[model samples]
Target: MLCLTGPTRAVTIDPPVLLAPMEGITDRIFRSLIAPHGGLGAAVSEFIRITVAPTPQRVCRRDLGPPIGVPVALQLMTPDDSHLAASVANAERAGAAWVDLNFGCPAPVVFSKCAGSALLAHPERIARIVATAAAATGLPVTAKMRAGISSPAHLRELVAAAAEAGAAAITLHARLRITSYDEPATWAWLAEARDALARCARPVPLIGNGGIETAADIVRMRAETGVDAVMVGRAALADPFIFRTAAGGPAPTVAEASAWALGYLDAIGSGSPKAKQLVRYWRCAGMLADPAQRQALLRGPTPAIAGFFTSLVPAGPAPPATRTSG
Candidate 1:
């Protein structure tokens, strides 16, 4: 747990931590595999790109059967205002618990459309989009964003625009649109976001994302950045159980991870699509293993990877990698 200093820190969201939506990762199967793991309180679906036409409910489902135990923010990505509003309504009609706008994706396709981080320079436009989505859905609406398009600064003005526009919460990914994963997370930006929100009349919870991988990062983030919580993406893909450990839930063993991994692959099915998704996913699961062991598994096939996990996990309560506890 993080110690308090200066003024008291409060988080309105429960579990306080959340799993981030990643392309190909954090999909429906991945979410179902990890959602019941005890620590995660919220979920965000992979970006549902909005077009001039309404997104089909079949596509909106994205294989999410139902809200198992928690609320899910169906993230809609688009540059069109009317389409965005329509998309949010369509998502809610299809059983969305919350609506999230994607102003954070830095993908080439997202850039070609001038959505996502491209709107960072246009705070007024971002505000207009948030307001439109919120009014359209009449449900809890949130947004995820990078600091800026070209500059690493501007979190102050950006966050206030989001808050005043009626976002129930906002997540700052702490990087510029052009910044890559090799860059360290600008945690100071989160501090800036907190201060900016504090000055707003409608200050909402600030959830920090980017570069939060280890259990230590989670604690330090809450204590140092003044964020209500942290969001995990690639690291969670490497170790799904990291969420449980970082948020004070019982940790899963190697044997457990092995079983879950096998089950997830099975659930995705054995078609060509399964093989394609599995290979890409296996590369990520290497992050679950220790450094000394990661490369071998990264190079090996699924059976070898599964065998490695089975051999390592003892037939007893597993010692967790994280120190976080309830």
Candidate 2:
């Protein structure tokens, strides 16, 4: 277990497995499901775009409210430094424990606006943005970034600038802006980042992300990259029980897992049309271990789908059709 002192207080992070702030995947329903698993140090919400105007009070109340007692960080993506600063202040007022600047999302739509990975090309702008956001919120600030724009040469400079601008920590995805899910993650890049971070004059914890799929993988990544923590993105979707397994805690039975899903549906209400779509998208992201089971659950009628997931527990053998794909 490693304890890092944030702006507020020391946060004890064991095993240091974090749930990445995936846009569609890290909603309240999923955060509730994954928090009880025990190995997670922090859970970040999906990136909220900070616009020129302030976020509406009602929307902020609904979206930024605490999902759980665990340290919840609010992620914001914006090209405008002033706008991003306003969003960070709003997030703090709305009860965010930390503010995370997103500079790693590869979405073309986001990059076109000079946000996300596009910030990588201008390290000075990144420093200014980080400084503004960190100053706006007295809370600890962090940044999630790609390895580099197109080469490793610029990554160290970006990290150094973020740290200089008051970022409490940095999470490196260990891939370039153009590296998609199709390409395998290069673990060596994480090691190089670790070395670079160590050379920085100030102390900043480096968190490794990408291609971590299991408890074992977390251990391996920590050993290989020498990072303070491992952030699980697609893998958490594959098995929400990963943190629990890594902590040597009991894994939820299949029935228990299903019941957890049912609870989420109940809390959110499946009556909404979007609820059904959420079920399909969440399962497809790799939360279900069995492919056949996942398909069966998704294809079934609403009531059937709810019942199927509610009845599963952790004891069963892998569903025969289980195949790993992101």
Candidate 3:
């Protein structure tokens, strides 16, 4: 178990696998669906942008919902530190276990506004944001960041800034802002960040992210980067059982996968068009490899799509649909 020291208490994450925040993907409904599979130590909400005003408690509650299965860290992002502390307070009131600042998002919409990875170019601003959040609440304050915005020259400085500013833990995505997801993540940089954190007066845990897919990848990342934990994003969407499989657990049976898909459909509501789009990811990765089956799933009616998934299960009583929380 990995113990993260919060201001008021320590949070222990067994298995040490956290769900990384993905913009359109890791919403409340998705978090609930993934909870039953069992592999994560914690989960992070999608980056909630705090602009001119403090984020409302309603917004935080909508994103966080009621704590379902695991502690969910409320992640916030902003172009400046104006309302960061207030936002953190709102998150605390809304039931966040801890808080994480987003300095690693690479989307152009977020970057164009000087938030997310754009903050990577300004270590001072990152420090101020972390300091504001650390002062605002008793929750463990963490920062998620890339190596740098456009270059690696300021990597150590950025890491040092957050660490020195009182961040309890740091998650390194290990890719520069300019890099594409297709590019290989430089695990070597994660090692460098680890070394820099060790030099701090109070060395905190480091979480390594990016390019993690299979159980083997999780093993390799921990061995190579020496991070206290590992976070998976895209991989989790493709395979909800990733955390389970990483821990040497068996992959889901066809019926089990079908039940997972149906439960997710129920959570999103059968009418959502998104329900049709998500089936591609909701299935265990590569389970729908047949071209005909893939097309059938996409072209089928939304309500009837559940039947297609059910067909994949063997002849027997259907697996019970797992209940999902909003």
For lDDT, the strongest prediction is 3
Rate residue 87 of model 3 by lDDT: 94
Q: Compose the digit string of candidate 2's lDDT tens values, residues 168-223.
A: 88899988998887688888988877777788787688888988867789889999
Tens digits of per-residue lDDT for model 3, 1-326:
67777778567888898999998888988898887778778999999999879999899999998776788999999888788888999999999989999999889999999999999989999999999899999889999999998888988889999998989899999899999988988999999999999998878889999898777798899998898899998888777888888888898777787777777778888888867667655547457767677778788888888777777766877899999999
Top TM-score prediction, candidate number: 3
> What is the TM-score ranking, best to worst?
3, 2, 1
How well is each residue in 1-326 modelled by candidate 1, as lDDT tens digits?
A: 21111111222345777778787777877788887876776778888888778777677776455665766668887775867777777787787667778998898887888888888878898999988887886577888999888785677889899889988888899989989977888988888888899899987878888897665677788899999878887767666777777777655655676666667656775332443344343433233435445555556665565455456555667777787788
TM per model? 0.83, 0.84, 0.91
lDDT of each: 0.73, 0.76, 0.86
Which pairs clash inside model 3? none
In angstroms, give how far residue 105 of model 2 lies from its true place.
1.3
